[model samples]
Target: MEDKRADVQELSDFELYVYETVAEIDKAGGAANIETLRNLIDRPEEDIWAALSHLVSANHVHSTAKGFTLGPHDWAP
Candidate 1:
């Protein structure tokens, strides 16, 4: 298997959870809005959104009027 340590070093467990959940949303052809994301993931609202903020700043995810999506690079920092 490919080593994922370098790719995911910066993300906390919850953040990884959020990121993966977002990917799932993408696979399902759905956007990850705050309300929907909250329901899909098991983390607390604050923690989920907090991870999302980090993901956005790192360019690993992007947000739109509709919702969040996997960013330009899927496995980037």
Candidate 2:
């Protein structure tokens, strides 16, 4: 399968949901970790990880030792 990268705006619904969830967590002063995502997102661990990978590659989300955060490209108003 071709691993074509999609733009942030063109991200799949699930990907967007993951991105938004991370953002929400960050806004709430909480770390957007895998465990936290698993708790909030009603999806399997693999799916969440995949969404996060894509988001990180697209610079929509930044991953750090602490957790996920908004990348250079701001999605905020």
Candidate 3:
């Protein structure tokens, strides 16, 4: 399987931060939603949503009923 880190080079600074934030929250056993991201990151709702969209489209993140979590590649070896 492809590694997600390889795709990080293509992301913008904010996008990278958002992706990392989602991973961090997931690592801590919490799901990340727009509200959770907004509260953690200092960016506005629009920017966070945009970043989430990009990350999801890139397959670096996944949106589920629980919330946003890292893609399979991110968690797998």
Candidate 4:
């Protein structure tokens, strides 16, 4: 095999799930918290929180006391 998975960056399943959730939320509107995002993404709390941390560090999302919102400059592409 020629390393077919080379294009992947070795993200955890939860991270990928979080990315999808963020994308969905961004498309729909913006911002989601643990409960709301959990409902939207239909995942567990731990996974969602872990992914949120990653997204926040990557500047793809932001966290507030209420919930998380897509970053203002996330559309830089």
Count of steric clashes across candidates, in order:
0, 0, 0, 0
Question: lDDT: which is higher, 3 or 4?
Answer: 3
lDDT of 2 at 23: 83
* TM-score of each model, paired residue for residue: 0.79, 0.82, 0.83, 0.60
Least accurate 10 contiguous residues by lDDT in model 2:
1-10
lDDT of model 4 at residue 77?
30
**Model 4: lDDT of residue 63:** 77
Write one digit per residue (lDDT tens) for candidate 1, span 9-62.
788888888988898887788789999888887768998888989988877778
lDDT of each: 0.80, 0.84, 0.84, 0.65
Model 2 regions lying over 4 Å from their true place:
1-6, 75-77
Q: Report the Cα lDDT for candidate 2.
A: 0.84
Point to the candidate with the largest TM-score. 3
Task: Give the winner by TM-score: 1 or 4.
Answer: 1
Model 1 superposed RMSD (Cα): 6.0
How do the residues 1-77 of candidate 3 rate in per-residue lDDT, one tens digit apiece?
66453367789999999988999998888789888888889988999999889888888889999899987663532
Candidate 3's C-alpha runs over 4 A off are 1-6, 74-77
